[model samples]
Target: MKVSTRPLWRKATLFKGVVVTLASLAALTVQASPAAADDVYGKPVGGAILVKYNELDRETGPLGCPTSIELDNPDGVGKRQEFAGGTIYWSAASNAHPVWGTIGGKWGALGYEGGKLGYPVDDERTDPDGAGKRQQFQGGTVYWHPTLSNGAHPVWGRIGELWASYGWEGGVFGYPTSDEGWEEPYQSMTQSFSSGGLTLFWSPGKNDETSWCKQECVGYSGAAGTDWFKETRVETYVGTDQVKVRAIPTRNGFNNARTDFHGAWNQVWSMAPYPKGINQVEHRSLYEQFACHAAWAEERLPGDWNTGPTWDLESWLPSIGMEKAIDPVEARKHKCNWT
Candidate 1:
């Protein structure tokens, strides 16, 4: 979309050299917009990656179990690799059943990883989406913790690290974050199951559970059996509600290289550098979707949500009249500043 950040209104004074104050510059540093998602297909903000993907995997019934593939952290700063690998399996059904997989498997560890959000081992039942006080998913069970990491892990991690590491770029080995707060998704597996056996499913949120609707979930071997290499074309939209897909890769570096489609991590990194940049700098998630926040270089353009003096992010909402006073009485009372 045409999201804007506060702009830098620099004026050259004949008597001074770049006479900007630390306070004004500091004001410009504030983030005034909603957080961005790091899906597989989208572009990055000035500082962090904007990861986007169409859909990881669609949920099928328990029989439609998926497998977890291990991922290596490229940053080389995370916890042990054994605990770092991602996994896939059929989550416990909304109902209880005998345990079938190794408890140490990726899903199992997170299932029992006790925390405020950790699923209660005492509960015998689970919902398809892993909601409720004691619901279970393919990876583990769900419990509500104030932090994202407290619930069953779609992949292994403390909630904050998971959200921060995999911003608007490709994850080291997993799916990117989404706009749904802690409700971000990793991937979904589709497979087949029989009544005699139990199936497992995994999702970032209990509200995200879906039935395969008879869609077939196959094993890796089964996926291999299909003509996966065959060319397939599907119609889809790219970019956000404001930016046009055709206008992406803007000639002036404004909305340039913009693609509404899910993007690759490497590509996202190119647009928004890591660390101090959007794709890499780690910050508290702006909103519940928990996407990484932004940190733009001096050379780049900012989004409408920026808190800089030149751009009053609150007043820049596209629907609002452009001339409206940025510091309205309500905004001023709340300490809202353009910078």
Candidate 2:
């Protein structure tokens, strides 16, 4: 065995050298051959853009085929590539993000990366509320909903902060219907939401304020008294609307009423919905309870009883003595009598 060891060792070294040479040739072939390179729609696409394109399933996915090679962004800080479906933007700070469909269209209208939104920081994703899609950018966020005819809209700045406070798309405001704009008379920034029914306004040195369509008055009742009386009315509508109660009183009878209730109670209270869910039956029942309470209060007030005595509904919450008639949760937990 020892006599043949030299020949065997030389043979093994020669085999290894051949393998290395072949590997080098293979690598060179791959580098030089356009056929072996990464190409989308006959266009060479590489780097981060290519990686993202692949992640999105290449030509088979929503991104379709590449229309342009990877190019430097106008800002010079990032790169972008166009595809049949959308564009992939890459930046050192934001990595790679794909914007497509209505969301992409909106971002483009806002001036692409050069707009106030800057580079997109995340891909378009289903909103947690499950009603729409949303994408985050360096400066703001864009949202899209199928039911909205205006397509996608951007939300940011103070108005964005306010929307976020209420729960974003899922909140009371729902999705934004309009982009932020300036109000010349008030010198404030304003944005519309809830299908243009609600508008949020922000001015210098002032907190955000909102105005929405006045809710339809669903229920009404009145109580009259010779010297003093109060009438309570409940107003609201279905679908993410505010519930308000108005207490109208005769000036001569309710002079002792709370100062807040001048001629009538102008304070407006808002609640998500009755019974803590979106049940129409329960909501209607809740409204009926409010009307019942108004009638009961009107009947209970003391006076000559010519028409009825107007009473402050807020003061009668604890002693209204109608817990059995109304759901304890609705009556006590929500303080439905006042709010």
Candidate 3:
């Protein structure tokens, strides 16, 4: 949901170079818009936006003739123009800088003008840590970080929203070190940030209470396992719970990675305190299915999973072979890890 923030957020935390005056922000309409989303493209636009378009390096930059007219900022006093490949934002202080590519695409997806992120405060720039590129917006930033499955993608969406609640770049998560990505089997928009990382997943496979559906939750944190070599694992969050498959590399066993798929964690937990209640049966089934999935990933990927690039399960499954279903009782003999 779109939330208004303290005026201090704009003038205080971020870069000093692009701060717009409070008086200017006060003069603009509340969430103003000059062009609708369905309007025609490549139409002529005038004023500050046109000046920025004229300055665009048409020869190399991913820009085209103005696609939308200079529109007014709904949250503040800013002007922006859309192009085929990028956008230009203008303010008295920040001038008009260009934002394009992955960052621009994400900006467009967030409703451009009407979305929660208000307006672009600055152009897209490479983050200092080199995790990836990002652009500042009124509410929060959109991050395009590198992933083991997909090279670099717009990984921050809802997780970014959760991050904002935690305190944005300053919160516990810090700036995103990796973009939120999906690992076929994982089903979460998993993203790693400066501090640590976050895993988020939504399940139509089961009811809400049993899973971390409505609330912002932190799932699992990988740690050293008993069977030796640093462990690598993936959990399938479904129904109401999750089932993890682990690769336990020991000194004796070079790449000893195995999971019975039934582990202790596979058992269904009770749903949350709610009115509608959660589906305990579906929740149990989801994790059981994950155990079979764990066996699949371990059988195929084998060895140290981290040694090479990560693959998306949704796509990788079909490429390898049709995934086989497993029964929780049969797999319990060789189940996964437990606390």
Best lDDT among the predictions, by candidate number: 2
lDDT of predicted model 3: 0.47
Rank by lDDT, descending?
2, 3, 1
**Residue 142, candidate 1: C-alpha displacement in angstroms:** 4.1
Off by over 4 Å in 1: 1-104, 107-312, 315-321, 324-339
Best by TM-score: 2
Model 1 TM: 0.19
Which 10 consecutive residues of model 2 have the lowest summed lDDT?
267-276
RMSD of 2: 12.7
If both were scored by lDDT, which would come out higher, candidate 1 or candidate 3?
3
Compared with the true structure, what per-residue lDDT tens digits does model 2 show for residues 3-46? 75467879999999999999999998888864334876698878
Candidate 3 Cα errors over 4 Å, as ranges: 1-46, 50-79, 89-97, 129-131, 145-220, 223-339
lDDT of each: 0.23, 0.60, 0.47
Q: Estimate each model's TM-score.
A: 0.19, 0.55, 0.35
Score residue 208 of candidate 1 by CA lDDT: 33
